[model samples]
Every structure is written in C-alpha cells, then in structure tokens.
Target: MRKPTSEKNQSEIAYEVLRQKLLNREFAPGARIRYGPLGDEIGMSATPVREAIGRLASEGLIELVPQLGAVVKRPTLRDTTELYEMREAIEPYAAAKASQLISARQLKSLQSTIDTMKKLHDAMTAGKKQGQDIAVRFDKSDLKFHQTIMNAVNNQRMLTVIGDFHLLTEIIGAARHSYSIEVLEMTIADHTAIFEGLTSRDPEMTRKAMTVHIQNSRELTLSRLQDECPQ
Candidate 1:
C-alpha cells in the first residue's frame, strides 16, 4: 500500500493532484468539484481538499460560487483571445532563441516527444484508440514538446510565465479538437517544421514556424469555444 502524506504535505499533495486532473481534463470545464466526494475519492479529508480547491481557484482553474462551491471555469471568448495573444507574443520568440541556443540533449528530448506525438497520432488515425484516452496522452506529449523548447531558452522567468499559460490553456480545454485525426496530423506537421528549423539552427525559420503553429492553434481554440460557449 502507498504511504499516507503528513498533515503539512497533504494540502500540497492534494493541490498537485487536483491541478493535474484539471489539466488532464478529467474534471473538465464547468465540472463541479465537491470537496467531500473528491476528498473521499482521493483518499484525503475535506479540509485538505478544500485547501487544494482554494489554490486552484487562485490559479483561475476553479471558481467558488455561492451555492455551487467549486466549479471549473470555462474560458470566455475574451479569456481565450488574451491567452493566445500572450502566447503569440512569447512562444515564437522563445522558439527562435531556442533554435540558436538549444543543446544536442534538448534536441534529442524534443525529438522523442515529437516521436511520441506521432505514434499517438497514428494510433488515433487507425481507430484503435478511444478519443479521450488518446487525446489526454497526446496533450501530455504536446506539452512536453513545447516545454522542451522553453527549457532550451534557459530563462527561469520566461519558463514560469509560459508554464502558467500552458496550464491555463489546458484548463481552457480548447485543445479538445486535437482528438480529431485532422488536427492531430496538422499539429504533427507544425511540430515537424519547428523541429527542422531548430535542427538547422535557423532562428528566422523557427520563429516563423512557431508563429504559424500558434496562429493555427489560436484559430482552432476560438472555433471550439464558439461552438461550445456561444454568446
């Protein structure tokens, strides 16, 4: 059996686990997060679960409502727009800088992530995998791919900023479209271009590729949001 967490570690442990569930879309946008049941499910008490909920609330992943207690926050159009705007401003530049400075080890890590995404894409296209399962796994690999590039940048502040944004995007749940074969293939192609630019040490090419990828991602996110949360 697994060891139980101490009183001090319980809250932090609960927070991390719940945060990951949100990122994994296991809770999903607009899902209710009841402290009691969730605490039971996670083998923790309501006190720690409530503390965890408060932390996620501060992160904008969960909102505390009058009667509802805690619910996942669905991103509005403005929320999605502002998010991609920050991403557009930050990530492409990071990619460019990474291309110039990325070490061989970072490149290998990135390639491995990309390869995992490709396999997930193939499994998705073959109709051998369920949508949610494959999508969740693919999302993890996709995040790793971007994070590898961000790690290559060697800027602590940038990494933390973009890391928060990535979590926000995961919470937004717009990447749901990636469950489809078309979007999965498109994403793979975009990652391929970014990888090629990085491999060749071409900053301009890397920036352009990342820019295009982010633009495409933004459009897809907006389209999904429009369909789900129309005003």
Candidate 2:
C-alpha cells in the first residue's frame, strides 16, 4: 500500500510539474515531450513521467502520435471559435447562477483575484514588458476569477467542461506568445464589470457582463491568430 501510494504521489507531482510547463509555454505548441529528459528535469523516473504524460494526453493537452511520442496540441482557429462558443453558451448562465448563489466569502476571494490581476496589469504597463512569471500569474488569476464563478455553481460537470475549455484557451494563448498590455487592461475592465454585477446580485447584469467578456476574448484571440499568420 505504501509503495503504491508513493508512486501515485510521484506521478501526481510529475503531472503538475509538466502541466505547469505546458501552461507556461515552456513547452510550446507542437513541441515534443521527451519522457526521459523531462523526467530528469523534473527529478522523477521515466515511469512516473510516462504516467503523467498519459494523464495530460487524456485531458487533450497532449496528443500521442504514432512513432512520434507525445507533443503539445496546437489549437487551430476553428478550435478557438468552438471553445468560445461553448463558453458563451455555458458561462453566462453559470455567472448568473453564481450571482444568485455565491457566498460573501466566495465573492471576497473572487475580488482578491481581480485585485491581483489589476496589480499585475499595472506592473506590465509600467515596465513595458510582461515577464514570463508575471504573465503566468496573470493568466492564473484570470482563470481563478472565472473558476470562482463556476465553482460557485456547484455543478461538477459544468466545472469539468469549463475547466477543459479554459485549459485549451491557455494552451492556444501561450502559442500566441504574451498578451498585449491593452488586452490585459481590457480584461481587467471586463472582470471589474463582472465583479460589480456579482456584488449587486443582479443575474441579468452578471450574465450580460460574462457574455461581453467572452465575446471580447473570442475576438481578441481570432485577431491575434490572424495577425500571426496572414495569408
């Protein structure tokens, strides 16, 4: 029992470590994930690393190619559009429900995430460059802000589906490199509006705010992708 538990723990560690690397764009889209070297870097054995890779593959974060091992999946424009569409369908409803059901404590936590994001956005604007770590944190806080709302919905399935879409968005966003400061500021404003709606416990306002935010995100993502590869 102890040995199996230890191996499971090791695998979980490897999974989280590798997941963070992928999320941070350390392993860029379509980059091959070599188990041996990655295991070495993460100070784990190949077995656990392989286990971790399999888990990520199951999550659609990595794809296993025949005779090519595993590579980070590169999200296409269609993929982005579909994901945003799903978010548009589901998240506004979730946000509206959250506005009705979220507790004061949860609202405080959500506000904290927004505050952190605002500081990060301000720092990036001042520095004229968003460092990789700051950018990663900003992404996390952004996710947390939304996750907080979804979690408030208390539906496991909704959380799972939305979480998957969020992960895919992160992967695609990483491939686009860092977001512009203007985009970050716009995100902050959108979040503020959402927060205000939640605070007022106005379901319609919350729903509308979430809708606009997701739509803006979809447009921004499409614009960036087009800019990156103009035909």
Question: lDDT by residue for model 2 over 1-231, one digit each (tens)?
Answer: 354447788899999998778767788888999999988997878899999999999988999999999999877777778889999999999999999999999899998998898888778878955567677888899888888999899999999899888888888888667767788888989999999999999999999999999999999888888755333
Q: Given candidate 1, what's the lDDT at residue 36?
A: 91
Using TM-score as the measure, which candidate wins? 1
Residue pairs with backbone overlap in model 2: none
Give me the runs in candidate 1 sitting further than 4 Å from their true place.
Answer: 1-8, 174-178
Question: How many backbone clashes are present in model 2?
Answer: 0
What TM-scores do the predictions have?
A: 0.90, 0.90
lDDT tens digits, residue span 11-105, model 1: 99898899788768788777899999888988888999998889889877789989889988878888888899999999999999999899999
Please name the candidate that would achieve the greatest lDDT relative to the true structure.
Answer: 2
Worst 10 residues of 1 by lDDT: 170-179
Error of 1 at 113 (Å): 1.5
Question: What is candidate 1's CA lDDT for residue 201?
Answer: 100
Query: Residue 119 in candidate 1 has what lDDT?
Result: 89
